[model samples]
Target: MSKPEFNSLNAIFINCTLEKSPRVSHTSRLIDVSKGIMERENVSVDEIRFIDHEVPPGEKPDMTEYGWENDEWPELFKRVMKADILVFATPIWLGDKSSVAKKLIERLDGMSDKTNEKGQAIY
Candidate 1:
């Protein structure tokens, strides 16, 4: 079989640092390294610092009740759906993934049954 052909490969790096403001995060730096590798391969890269956004913790995929598509998590999910690769970068905290990282996973879990325009599973 031949290798898959892609016009462009998009990657999203979800940085799950606990910092509340725009502070330098080690997790983000690690993502930068990975991003550089992807860039060398001609893949578009996008980074999202979870701590910088007000993403609430829940199993609801889209935040429609709270003003549909107005929440950051849903907007971020949109970007994730369009990407070919996804990287979840987070610093280990107390022998476990950061709280923000766990929360992001929970939010994404809600989209496990979602489908794309072509009726393919987004997860």
Candidate 2:
């Protein structure tokens, strides 16, 4: 069998900063630098600021099914599943990752069992 072709890679950068858009986020700036380098190598990049969206906290694939009035995790998760690379950008708080970062991680754990078309675990 022939080897699989590697045309390009898709990356999703999830900024888990506490601050919203238009606000200064050191973590986000760092992500931008990395994003530029990846783009130079022909990688398709997508960014998501966790704070800007209303993503209710829950340990499930879709929080809406868990009684959340609205959830953005499902949509964001879709992007994550489609990407070849996942980048979480968050500032260190008290020697630990930010809350947004933790939340994203937990939410991701909800889908830890997810697999790609080839049945390989996404994580």
Candidate 3:
């Protein structure tokens, strides 16, 4: 068997650090490791630091009611839609995933029903 091909693959790493202005942290370290692995496979990588952005937490998926035009989530979702792979990088805090990570999941829940071109669920 030959190695799998990933020349056209694109990936996004959502770093869910709690710090508003996160400095070097464990979550970033994990992202670095993943980046190295993906780069070796020729996979394009993009990263998003949720804590650095104004990501308001709510159960609602779209932020239209809260002025979606100015929200960063819509743009982020668009990037996720275009990616072939998504890596959720979050540090476990007190036996739970980081709050930002949970918020990310909640935000994505609204897209769970949507399917990809291959008839697979996007979320």
Candidate 4:
């Protein structure tokens, strides 16, 4: 079979389900939305990036060394840099996005355009 054409629709799913929030249900709902977009657009999806903010016991999740790419360091920024469109779907916690989502947002510093004084994206 021929390989499918790759179209851009970058997706980021962040789980912010406090300690008792229903996470999977919310995420499933978001997935349905993404699927609907894909079906409506008639474009092939290249990738879906899912970031789980819920950490394991005694472990810190950092973009620099998240173990997703071994101990080589720096993976999240690389992925973000390649995405053409970003979709951030996160559960609300304490009336705000989860800390994991916030961390992911902070990591966006590496992808900044660096032209604007306020770091407004030029791309």
Badly placed stretches (over 4 Å) of model 3 are: 67-70, 115-120
- Which residue pairs of candidate 1 clash? none
What is the lDDT, from 0 to 100, of the residue 36 in candidate 2?
92
lDDT of 1: 0.82
Instruction: Give lDDT tens digits, candidate 2, residues 1-123.
Output: 985443488998999999999997899899999999888777899999999999888788888887889998888888988899999988996899999999998999989898879999878
User: For candidate 1, lDDT tens digit of each residue in 29-114?
Assistant: 88888888888777888888888876777778666675654567878888888888989988996789998889988988978988
Kindly list the per-residue Cα lDDT of model 4 for residues 53-120, writing each as its tens digit: 22222123343354443321145444544555555656676798766456556545433544446767
Looking at model 2, residue 20 earns an lDDT score of 90
Top TM-score hit: 2
**CA-lDDT, candidates in order:** 0.82, 0.89, 0.82, 0.47
lDDT of 2: 0.89
Question: Of models 2 and 4, which has the larger lDDT?
Answer: 2
lDDT of 3 by residue, 4-122 (tens): 99989999999998756548888898889989999999999998898787667765656767665545777888988888899888889689998889989988886688787999977
- In angstroms, the error of model 3 at 123 is 3.2
